[model samples]
Target: MAEGKVDPVHQFTIEPLFGTDHLSLAGYNIAFTNSALWMAITAFVLIVFVGGGAKQALVPGRWQMAVESFTGFVDDLLRANIGASGRAYLPYVFSLFMFILFANMLGLLPLALVGLHPFTPTSHFTVTGVLAIISFSIVLIRGFTKHGFHFFSLFVPHGTPLAMIPIIFPIELISFMVRPFSLGLRLFVAMMAGHVLLEVLSGFVISGTNAGALTFGIAALPSFLLMVGICALELLVAGIQAYVFALLTCVYLNDAENLH
Candidate 1:
């Protein structure tokens, strides 16, 4: 009999879902990829969650209560940070939160079924980068609309000495420019690292089972334990990153409102 393939790290490969050539336009190649499918799934989940929970009541049922709690939490966060004006941005913030939370959770599922493929868009820089850019644009447009030409003064700071203006101005400009980079990188790195770790540990469990069934059986326990622990951690991260993104949005909105 042929020896079983023992290579590790084969699970993370990004393969096309269908045989069709990926759609190419300009320099960007778009495909009906697993990532795209999962993003759609995430959107569907958000729609269902919100739509199903639309009914309001003084005493709510399970779904209604869950949705109400989330809405209330976001409302409180906005009020505390952005004040009454924050209500205007609630829909955008809510959509962002649910989309991200669903995406991260869906990526944790068994994505290697015969007919279905699962992939994490959050692991891709392009997806995260786009999200960051959208948030950045929101801030920029709000700033420009509210403050007019004076918004550029944000880089100058209030108390800097005249001699340090040249030095400090460029630094502030660079920092502001890099906000999207930092935001995108933070979420991408965290999701990528967590998934990679889970994949490596899973590979060990599978490979060991082929080598020595009994010994591997024992070793598999820890792998399973770690997988569960990682799942919980990922769940926390999913909610947290969503909140961080939304919170930063509110903070930027507040800055625009105050012309700071």
Candidate 2:
């Protein structure tokens, strides 16, 4: 972030790993960025981990079991929320869940202590927003394809009096339209806020240590402990946020699959 002081927001900075001058295509720079690198890292790791784990075993190894456990968890989640048809969407939903899960988990690595910075791509609204858009698009496309114009009924509650149609319709429609923004913003804010806080506490630790033994004991010690606690909490949040995003996705898909 800075010399002798941590810049909490610096972790989220997106910088091109290579000089930006060398590449341009369709009016967009083709330079690879630190953010893109981490995303690629996340994708590569998932491909290896999930791909290797997909092999079924007669006596199921721990690795396979672990993969199955996570998949099955998502499976059950979808079944409960979206019913039998949900199984058809497993490949996509599972991938989305695991991608977010691994990206988040990897970003929390303590590589900064080793002079390497770990970037959490999810902290950026652009990444999360794209994800939200894809999920929302699937819902919209599937709903219209399956139910046609009847899908519009999603914004109209059943049993509402005809007189209330003007009032209730706009409110529900506005609420429905806000889903993608809320979905993306929720994950982006949660991930970014946690990292910022950890960075700030880290700054306190560094500052206190440099001050003197007294400050180190009183200030840095507490900050360090708080950092430790936050790390654990962040691990929990990573999984929860992934699950929440996937869960909400299932919920939205339900509206598409079975209009209500």
TM-score on alpha carbons, each prediction = 0.86, 0.95
- Report lDDT per candidate: 0.78, 0.92
Q: Please report the candidate that would top TM-score against the real structure.
A: 2
Local accuracy of candidate 1 as per-residue lDDT tens digits, 1-260:
12434333343455655853567678677766767778888898888998888887778899999898888888887788888988887887777777877888788777565555467778778888898889888889988998888988888988999999999989988998888898888888777887878776666667666678675777766787888898788878877887887787677667776755
Model 2 quality (TM-score): 0.95
Query: Which residue pairs collide, candidate 2?
Result: none
lDDT of 2 by residue, 96-206 (tens): 999999899999999978999899999999999999999999999999999999998999999999999999989998998999999999999999999999989989898
Error of 2 at 126 (Å): 0.5
Segments in model 1 whose C-alpha atoms lie over 4 Å from true places: 1-29, 111-115, 213-221
